[model samples]
Target: MSETGRLILLGAPLGNPADASARFREVLAAADVVAAEDTRRLTRLARDLDVSVPGRIVSYFEGNEERRTPELVDVLAAGYTVALVTDGGMPSVSDPGYRLVRAALDAGLPVTAAPGPSAVTTALALSGLPCDRFCFEGFLPRTPGGRRSRLSALAAEERTLVFFEAPHRITGALADLAAAFGADRPAALCRELTKTYEEVVRRPLGELAEWAAAGAPRGEITLVVAGASATPAQRPDDDALRAAVAEREAAGLSRRDAITEVAAGYGLRRREVYGLVHEG
Candidate 1:
């Protein structure tokens, strides 16, 4: 490491002020420079936690992170302890701080963390869905097509899934999820986590969609979706397939057309349908 000051990545409180760690407070107050996702939020948090920040505070959100990384790293390289924090949860978990952290590392500066509350893990813990194996898919795409395409890709995922969502679009997102993953797939909707109006709804996707449709819930939302069961569908017996083909034929369709339609509906190949329709 260079003979320079260390860079500290401080995890801020997710929702509750009390969730702020003593170490987080201590570091925030003692650092030479404090780079926050939102300066006003940082000040509010300082006042709430009663930790006076004596360091030079600067803004560092998505819009400014790119330009601020090198400046913060320069301060760190100048032998001044620079503290990085976000408005909620740890920096870089769907937030800023990656650029600064990387810049510090590239400059051979020492880097550390004062880990605090995290929305991702917090929501996952609250979700009654299986937690042993899960994936965090932060915020679905805004466009309808993009959102549905993303969900379709995850249709075969066997591990539970987590997602962050906006309150206004939660209803539409839930409906899309149900469409892509099926109505009966179990899920949990965690809202206003660690806040006064916190609510956790555990039910099937379809039910949740209906609930949201009636009235969209407000505040920060986290959704946990159960993964696919992976159970194979039972194929129809030869007799049953023949009976279905015969019915279709009796309805004015030829044998070939009947077999074709039935095969398409059942996701079977033409050869398979033909064998079933002709075999005893």
Candidate 2:
């Protein structure tokens, strides 16, 4: 391991600066170069920790990441320890710094982390949902149709799913999820994780939709949804499939759209529904 080059992937506190790990402070204090997603946020964090970064600090965010990575890579290759920090949470998890990490790894550079608070893990812990096997789904698309299409693709996912969403759109996102999955699906809404106003509400998707409708929530939001349950082996009978297609078609959906909707509802393949629609 010593023969390989090293790059530090530091996890910053999501909200509270005091949650920073001892290793996080040591690395920031001693690193030869610091690549931060947001230099202002990094500076504030440094002040919070009362640690001064002795090395160079450079910005590495989505807009200029491509241009900045090569320079950082050169520094790392020169045997200078480079530390990567995002505004909050772990770098490269729905945050900046993935490109640099990939570049470093492909070049056989060693990468390590100062583990600390993460919205993903923190939300999972606070969600009260099944965390044994889960997937992180970053943020969903903003548009209604695009978001719905994305949710449709994950309709059959068997493992619990976590998603980051804007507070303003939480209600609409919950409504869309309820439509894509079922209303009764179990889910949890974690808000302002690790902050003074942190909140976690566990309920069915339908109930969550209702709650969000009543009022908008503030702060960052993390949604944890229970996975689809195993269903009986028997396929939706032909009549059932036909009726589903008919119901959707009557609602003004095109034949193709109806098939997609019905198939998603029954957790069946679109082809299965198409076959039934034709047979009927």
- Winning model by TM-score: 1
How does model 2 score by TM-score?
0.79
Q: List candidate 1 segments past 4 Å from native.
A: 231-280
| Candidate 1, 1-280: lDDT as tens digits | 2357998999888778998898998998899899988899889989999999998999998998888888888888788999899988888888898888888999999899998888888888876556799898988999889999999999889888999999899999999999998876767799988888888886668879999999999988889887775652466888888898899789866676566556544545556878876775
Tens-digit lDDT string for candidate 2 (1-280) = 1334478999899888999999999999998889998999899999989999998899999999999988887777877899999988999999897899999988778888888889998888766555899999999999999999999999889888999999888999999999998886767889988889988887668778999999988889999987786662456678977987798688766686567545544556557778888978
Assess each prediction's global lDDT (C-alpha) against the native: 0.83, 0.84
| Ten-residue stretch with the least lDDT total in model 2 | 260-269
lDDT minimum window of 10 residues, candidate 1: 260-269
- Error (Å) of candidate 1 at residue 235 is 19
lDDT of 2: 0.84
